[model samples]
Structures are given as C-alpha cells and as structure tokens.
Target: MSASDIRAEARRVLGICDACGYCNGFCDLFEAARRRSALTDADLAHLANLCHACRNCFQACQYAPPHVFAVNVPRTLARMRHQSYLDHVWPQTFAPLLNHPVATVIGVTLGAILLLFALVLAFAPAGGGLAIETGATAGAFYRVLPWTLMVGLGVLPLGWSALAIGLGWRRYWGLTRPRRATTGEARRRWCAWRTTLADILNLRNLRGGGVGCNDLDARFSPWRRWLHQTLLGGLGLSFAATLAATFYHHGLGLQAPYPLLSPPVLLGTLGGIALMIASLGLGWLEWRTAPEPIASESRRLDQAFLGLLLAVAGSGLALLLWRATPAMASLLVVHLGTVLAFFMLLPYSKFVHAGYRAIALRCESLDPVSID
Candidate 1:
C-alpha cells in the first residue's frame, strides 16, 4: 500500500485509540499522557515503542464505552513495522504463515495434540503393570516415574521439535512445495516481522509511562523498564534453571525432590513467582481499571489465557506452601499443560502478538517515510 493509504489507516486507528482511551482508559499510552497533562507527538512515539501490539489494551478497549475504535494495534503499527525491516532488526523470520489464516490454526492444533498425547501417556499407568521392569537398582521404583516422564515429556517435546522443523522446511525450503506469495502480501509479512520485534520485544508503543498513581513507582531509571526488564530477568532465570535441572536429572541420572535450595528448583521457583506477579499485577491493571465500560468487552480467549497464567502461578505457590504430593504434581502438570497450550495454540491466540510485534518493528525500520 502507498503512504497515503497507510496514513489514512493510521489516522483511523488513532481515532479508535482516542475513543477507547476516552471511555476505558485502556490506552495506557494516552493514559500516561493524561497523567502528565501532556500528550504530544513525542509521547506518541514513546507510546508506539511501548506497544507490542498484544491487543490486550485494544481488546479491553473493544469492551469499552465507544466501540467505534477497534484499533487493531497490529495493523496500526504496520507503518512503523515497515520501517524496522530495512534496519535488519526483525525479531522473527516470517513467511506464508504470516498471511495464511488456515495454516496458523492447523499448525497450532496439531502442536497441542502432540503434546497432550505425551501428557496422557505419561500420567497413565503402563498396560500390564504399575511397575514396569527397569534394569536399574533394586528398591528403585524407578520403572514408572522417570520412564513415563521420558516418554511423555522428553519424547513429546522431541516430536514437537521434529514436527516444527519438518513442516518449516517443507513449507519454506522443502523439495515438495514452493510458496507463491504476491508482492503486496510479501511486503506485509515483512512488515509483520518488523512490528513484532519493535512492538513486542522492545514494547515501543505502550501509550504512556504510567498513570499518576503508577508513574512515581514506575521509575525508568538506568536500572530498568519496570514490567519489561523484570519480566525478561524472570523469564531468563527461570528458563536457565529449568534447563539445568532437566539436564542433571533427566539426562545425567539425577532425581526429583532435588533439594528445594537446588539451583534449578530454587531458581525456577523464584523466577516463576516473580513473573507470575508481574504478569498478574500488570495484566490485572490492564483489565481491572481498564477504562470502565470498555473493559467489559474483554474476550474469552484473552481472559482465559491470562487467567491460565495466573492459575499456573497460584498452583506453583500452593505447591510450595502446602507441599501436598497429589496437589503439587497436579498443579505442576497443569502449569505444564497450560504452557503447552500456549505454544500449541500460539497462532490462534493473542500471544501471537509477541512474534507479530517483533516483525512489525522490523517493517517500521524498513520505511518510516514510506508510511505516510
């Protein structure tokens, strides 16, 4: 599309942004402005940067008073995304799936099924016995516990990786099928990648710093971006801890009930708790004070996803506090299941915003002037 079209679309989106903000206070971007008594073009730029296009704000706005502005931030930020691409800072590599609606749904569905199967088998007792004969030491009830885990967790994840790799290869560089994307679609796909990076990773378009009540506390000091940095730190630490534990136990022959102070268990618990709080608190603010009548329009999918996340955190905490075996295992499984659901249902959920935001940022870098 030409710059004129992009501008018209953007203005239309801005109108939606304003309307939603007016009714719902969902537009934290403008909320920040309202708090500071200043909403300038510069603030808009800052807001743009902070916007990962998660659509939570927009979704909340849709549920707001004036439904006129269904400003799909993803499309609204396309112009900036167009610019990010030329800068070679795209977050995700995109292809036909960027535009292929059916592909996204199917891919996510298959992924979920693959994982669920693993979970079922892992949980289920073996065909003939509760205790499958293992070549391990005597008194080791090792037969069922870890073996089930290996087949269910380890094997299934492997299958998922294989499926993704094979499908990606066949779809992109495969021998059987070659993609045929029109030039216009191709450009948009590239734009998607750009926006995904800038909007999601960098969160370049959050609308504002924070409302008055939140601003003073949200210090943008050299230490960090409140939600962003805390989140990243937590995720990084948690993932590392998970990997370490998985390797030591699953790979090198260690066991569960690793000391609570163990690296992986402790770190993962800490990280998980921190992320749980950050995600829940910030996300709650997004929904709760989400600008009145607008907030009511929250979608089931978004609510369910975030709620699932909250539940996972709660379950983890419960495990620690109560330390009930059945409850702990069940909650852990639920946490795993929800996380699996997230990845499996990825393309179909708002979480897709993460990848798309990065892509959008790259697109913006490619052509800012071209947008208008």
Candidate 2:
C-alpha cells in the first residue's frame, strides 16, 4: 500500500477510536491516542510503534468487524508500523527488501557462508585448516580461521549495522520532533524520557493495563510478557558475553576458546540456551495465537527474524559443544557466517523495531498526561 493510503486509514481509525474511549487502558497506543484530539503524522507514527500487536483491543472492541465501525486497531497500526520501517530505513535503496524479507535474508546469508567456506578451504595452513582437529586450547579457533579474518568478520558487519540503525533512528526521531526547543520544553522532554524509558524497560503496556494481553484467546494471560522478557534478557546477556570476550582478547590479551568456568564461556553458553528457547517459544506462540489483523507480510518478516536468531544461537552452541573435534573447523565458519548475516540484516529486519519503539516512547513521554 502507498504511504498516503496508510496515513488515511490510520487517521480514520484514530478518529473513531478517539470518540470511543473503551480501549483507553489496553496499551500505550490507546493511551497516547486518548491524549490527542486528532492524528498527525507524528501522532500516527508514535501510536503505531507503541502497539505490540497483542490483539486485546480487537477482542474487546464492541464495534469490531461485523459492525459498521470495523475498527481493527492492531491490523491498521501494524501496517503503519511496517511503513515507518520502510520510510526510516537508511540507504533508502534497500528499503524494498522489507516487502518480503525472508528471501533476501536467506540468499545473502547462504552466499556469505558459502563464500567463507570456500576461502577457508582455499587458504588452509600447511597442515590444513579443515579435516584436522585443533584440540582444546586457548588459541585453538585461530588454527581453523585466522584471528585477523575472524575478528574482521565480527567487527565490520557489526559496525555497519550500528551505523545503519543509528541513521534510521535519527530519521525516525526527526519525524517525532525528538528534541526539546526551550527550557520548559527541555524539562518536559526529560520527564517524557523518564516515563518512556520506564515503560519500555518494564514493557508496562504488554500487561494490557492491569490484566494480561489477549495473547491466545479472549482470556488474558501474562505468558506473552514473560516470553518477551526471556527473549530480551537472553539477547542482552549474549551481547554482554561478546563484550566480555572482546575485553578479554584486547585489554587482557587473552586468547581464543576460554574454559567452561570462565566468564565469557558461561555467559555465552547460558545466553545461547536462552535465545534458542525464546526463539522457539515465540514461534510457537505466534502460530497458536490469532493474528487476524497482523498482515501476512509482517508475519513473514517476523518469522525471518526469528529464524536468524535461532540460527545464531543454534550454531553458537553447536560450535561450543564440539570445538575440539574435526567438525569444529566447519562449525566455526557456519557460526561466524550466521553472525555476519545477522548483523548485515539487522537494520532491515525486525531488529529495527527496538530503535523505532524507543523513539516513539520518547515522543509519548513528552505529553504531560503520559506521566505515570
């Protein structure tokens, strides 16, 4: 759909929703909408990102579907949210990949893995990089993949993803008037910042105000919130593990393949398990629940992202478990390749949602009524 069409539909839904305050306490989207007289571009973008697609409002709405109002807030806001991703994505030229992202992600990831595998095979050391056991040691991994190439693979893709995400976030923030223009404005924005940050960290709206979200059916449950927390916590821990490893390697001059009792190994092992479980759980939850309003395209994008996360976690664990065997060499390549793929796709995938949502929350916090 075109941008203008999305904006029009969003405005129509917002107008109807504004008149009926039944869903005012369901989520941040509704609460923010309640404070607005009409929907502007900024208002729509903020409201769209605030939505978590829990489908609570749809289940609770009296004027839903069969009625004339036909107010499907979740579905409407989801499409608008997708549009925002496309609009704010950096490089602008690659934004079309958001249309059906699974193909692009799969193709790019496989190609990178294959290319890395070929390079490893072609440039093996005199004893050979593959088909030989490196044994368990501090610098065993480098015997398979050179430390320079491995580090380059790790750093370059992450740097690119960070830059792209930063650019996209800046653009989105501009749409929402992200900065304070005056002294009072600065204080108000600061207040909003605190409110928004607290709400995001706790995922306050995921609880459907007080009750839980309408996750599986009309009945409310906190399973979705719990699962989301698991996912975020796992991801955060995994990132911390990487940082710890980086510090060990650079600051302390430690080498590869730390022992199981070490901080990096323990953190990564637990994180991998968490990520794997959360990815699987989220996929199951999406399958079991009713996503009537969430578009097929958006669901596909979500699946693609979950697929990448699973690949990263699965391969990481596999490598860790069998690092001393001949299989370690190939496993290292697969693991690093998947990591590279994850970073390269980060800006265009569901990962971008975090940045967009953070900006939206910042905008919402600026409203005086949004406090607490």
Candidate 3:
C-alpha cells in the first residue's frame, strides 16, 4: 500500500479502537490514542513506536478477522512503525536500504570480508603462513592488521553511523515531540526521562498487560521478553567492553590481548555468549511466530538485523578461541568485516527502532494522564 493508504488504514483501525476502549489497559498506546481526536502522520508515527507488538490486543480484540471490522492493531501498527523509520531516516539516500535490508546486509558483509581478504593477501609478508601467526605478544594483533588500519576501519563507519542515527533522532523528535505548553515543563521532562528510562530498561510494555508477550501462540510467554532483555543487556556489556578496552589502550598505555581476568576480556566474553544465545533464540521465535500479528514487510529486515548480531557475536567468540591458532588471522578478518558492516547498516536497519521507541516512551510519559 502507498504511505497515505497505510496512514488512512491506521486511522480507521485506531478510530474503532478508541470508540471501543477495550484495550485501554492493554498498553500505553491505547491511552495515547484516547487522547487524540484525530491522528496526524506524526501522531500515527508516535503511536506506532509506542506499540511493542506484543500481540495482546490482537488476541483480545473482538473485532478481529472473521468479523466485519477485521481490526488488526498489531499488524497495522507494525507497518506504520516501519514507515516511520523510513520517513525519519537521515540523509534520505539510505532510506531505500530498508526496502531490501537482508540483501543489503549480506552484500555489505560479504563485500567487506572480500576486501579484507584482498588487503591481507596484498600486504602480509611473502613468507607469512595462512594464520599470519603473530606470536602471542603484546602487539600481536597489530602485527597481522596494523593499528592504524584497524582504527581507520572501525572509526570511519562507526562515526558515520552515529551521525546518521543522531540526525534521524532529531528529525523524529521534531515530528512527534509533545507540543502542549505546561507549567513546570522542565521538571516534567526530567520526570519523563526517568520514567522512560526505567520503562525501556525493563521493557515494561512487552509484559503485555501484566501477563507477557503472546509471541508465538495465543498463550502468553515470557520468552520474548527474556530474549529482548538478554539482547539489550548483551549489547550494553559489549559496548562497555569496548569502552574499557579503549581506556586501557589510550589512558593506561596498555595494549590488547589483555589477560582473561581483565575487564575487557571478561565483559566481552560474557557479552558474546549472551548475544549468541539471544540472537539465536529471537530468530527462532520470529520463525515460529504467527504471521497474522506481524508486518509481512518487516520480516526480512528483522532477520537481517538478527543475522548481523549473530555473525558479529559468533565471529568474535571464534576469534578469541582461535587467536593463537592458524585460523586466527582468518577469523579476525571475518570478525572485523562483520563489525564494520553492522555499524555501517545500523542506522538504516531495525536497529533504529530502539532510538525511536525510546523517544516514544518518553513522550508517552510526558502526557498529563500518564503522570502518577
């Protein structure tokens, strides 16, 4: 459907939902909807982000399929949420990547790996073995891939991704941020920030009206919530590990190949294991989920994001295991390539949902009715 049709459909469904009021207690989205007499594109986008796709309302909906109304809130909002991502995307040129995310992700990953392989073949010493076996010395990693080259590879993509995501966040805020003037605006915003952070950290909405997400079947299950928490936690730890490594390298004048007991190594190891498990589990859940409640268009994008996480986590763990072996150099190249692709595509992929959702949650908390 065209963008206008999608918005029109969403408005129709939400209008019915507002009149019914059966789902007001299901999620914060319903409350937000109740307050809106008419939904603009911006309001629809905000509501889309507010929905966690828990499918609770879908299951409880009496006007669902087989009925004349055929109200399918989850599916409609899912499409709208995706459209919002495209609408607010930074640089505008990258929006097309969202249309074929899986292909884009795979192509970028393979291209990076191939380029890394070519660089290795062209630059490594003539007699260096397949492993490019740099001894387990302080600067062994740099021996295979120079520190300068590694820094360039990591920094450039990450810097661009940050800029893109930041700009997109700004645009979304401009579109959906609450405009009502109120007394104690600063205090209310501070409270909203705190409430939103707590909600995001715990994924309060995924609880599906105090039970759990109806992820795979009609039955409520905590599996989705657990997997989401694990993924978010794992990513957090992994980022923390990177920051720790940076501190050790630049602040303390220490090099990598840090001891197993060191903060970076320990954090990264735990994070990698969690990421692998969560990525695999989430993929399985997605595969088994009932198709009726999801946006068909988003399946590829979801899978592509999960695949990138799995590749990064799996390759990093493999590199750590085989760092001293003949496979170390090959694994290193694959790991770095996957990381590069992940960062480069992050802003254009499902990863942007986290930022958008956080903003939505904060906006919801800012509503007068939401305050305790």
Superior by lDDT: candidate 1 or candidate 2: 2
Candidate models: Cα lDDT each: 0.44, 0.82, 0.88
- Tens-digit lDDT track of model 2 for 275-305: 8998898888778877666677778888889
Best by lDDT: 3
Candidate 1 or 3, higher TM-score? 3
Query: Where does candidate 3 clash, by residue pair?
Result: none
Runs with alpha carbons beyond 4 Å of true place in candidate 2: 178-190, 368-372
Least well predicted 10-residue stretch by lDDT in candidate 3: 127-136
Candidate 3 residues lying further than 4 Å off, grouped into runs, are: 125-131, 182-184, 368-372
Give one digit per residue, the lDDT tens place, for model 1 in 276-366.
8767755665554424212121233344445545554665566555442334434344445555544444333334334333332443443
Which TM-score value belongs to model 2?
0.94
Number of clashing residue pairs in every model?
A: 62, 1, 0
Q: Across residues 1-372, which tens digit of lDDT does each residue of candidate 3 receive?
A: 889999999999999999999989878899888787668888899999999999999999999998899899999999999899889898998899998998999999999988877877766655442456664456666656777788898999999999999999999988888777666778877888899999998899999899999989899999988999999989999999999999999999888778878999899999999999999999999999999889877877889999999999999999888787778778888998999899899899989999999999987888733221
Model 1, residue 21: C-alpha shift (Å): 17
| Deviation in Å, model 1, residue 116 alpha carbon | 8.0
